[model samples]
Target: MLTLYRPGDGPWHRLPAGPKSLVLLVIVLGVSLLPATWWCAAVAVGACVGCYAVRGAGMRDLLRQVVTVRWILLVTLAGQLVFTGPETAVANTARVGAAVVISGLLTLTTPVSELLDVLERAMRPLAWLRIDPQRAALTVAVTLSTLPVLARLEREVREAQRARGGGRSLRLFAIPFLVVALKHADALGDALTARGVR
Candidate 1:
């Protein structure tokens, strides 16, 4: 999956990070709320396309990037088709698939720093709840950063497994990844503490 952040200086980069985070939730909810009809999906797609364009994204680039998560999108679409009536299957699947792509566009347009800034801002109210806002923001940052780290490790491990013909064994793959993730998680916690984010 593509990350939501990149170094940039566009208008999106200048916008308050707090508002952008809410947008992620809005995109998913708005997409899911539409009726399972061809016209609705078409409208959703058009709306999403407009949002992307407003954020300076090209249609081809958007489509090309969504290829990373196509499998998940396909599975979702397939599930909707099998359960929903055949008459509405195509429309439903299209809507679901388009929604995923459209929502993903927000990530592509927004930088991850903006995300952490949003996280920090959003968690401010936690102080009233006796929660440490810095700790909360650090937690969110760790969570966000892990996806990329794990993806890197998985790619490396999968390559090594394929070399040794261990790729076919689910047990071999899962165990190593879990072990590495645990070790990394501990180190991350230590780093956060050292930085006084806790």
Candidate 2:
């Protein structure tokens, strides 16, 4: 699986995944509710940075994850600016960027197996409703793993287009990317079946 976990001997890595995940959820909820003010944004961003530093992750590692969503952030900022004015847009962007960084920090610190185990355990209560916790956890794991694959595929397609001196064309990229993604999904499904994951 394409997990963001990096092997480290840091305290964050040593922490129990269950509690860590709970804390992550709490932090996300709290942050999401904060007013989109400059100070709130600064605190949110600073907290993420501080957490990374405490966990011994480098700045470049954090930037790598954050940069992936730059285009989305840009578009969001543009729309907010047009609709709500510059101050709100800036605050909103900062709020969003901070959330993304915080999420990335969590994934970077926790291993995929640990995350899945925690998720399955947390969903155990749903068993009373005839819901399969393992299946739900596996689905989430697969979805998380697929994101990096799609991101890498997009980057590869972009690079290939540039190499061929092609103009910016979504049409040229979308079809092949979709085909590759579908094939990847099929292969992933086969692997999961072989492992008796679902």
Candidate 3:
């Protein structure tokens, strides 16, 4: 579910990131902004999983993925259920959340390189505007890659602080990530400049 290092030799794993990203964007936007309906939502989820199955994804691995992402979706769905009529709210929550889950499924199925390629192809139209699309795509891809690393760093930092008798607070969680991000951003910028990529 965390999708740490689920490497495989499947066709999806070989897909370029750019096309996969395009598919993710289209599906997420379509499913999220469309009408709220339980049946529709169920179909969307099934379609996502179907893609995995077609690509030879196993049940246990997919279940782990669902478990990893379900925590937030479940909480949101719970709140939605409490605030609105059960029938309407439940349907709407499922529709919206299924979109999110589908997007995650795309990410899990597609490799990051494929995502980059997708982005590059997408940004081709903007070439007339003197935009470096690959650079832009790389920026996004790099940010995505950094998310888990930063999360892990934040967890380690918090645990170290707690071990030293530090109290829990949002600030403790926020500060370490922000500081680390800033430092890394600077280093990345410097590297890009050195390579004439900036």
Candidate achieving the largest TM-score: 2
Poorest stretch of ten by lDDT in candidate 2: 1-10
Cα lDDT, model 3, residue 71: 51
Tell me how many residue pairs clash in candidate 1. Answer: 2
lDDT of 3 at 194: 93
The residue ranges of model 3 lying beyond 4 angstroms of the native Cα positions read: 1-6, 14-26, 53-83, 86-89, 105-111, 161-168
lDDT top scorer? 2
TM-score of each: 0.70, 0.90, 0.67
Full candidate order by TM-score, most accurate first: 2, 1, 3
lDDT tens readout by residue for model 2, 73-105: 798899898999776787788777666667766
Question: What are the clash counts of all predictions, listed in order?
Answer: 2, 0, 11
Indicate the residue-level lDDT of 110 in model 2. 82
In angstroms, how far off is 79's CA in candidate 3? Answer: 6.8
Give the least accurate 10-residue stretch of model 1, judged by summed lDDT: 1-10
- Residue pairs that clash (backbone atoms under 3 angstroms), model 1: 5-111, 5-112
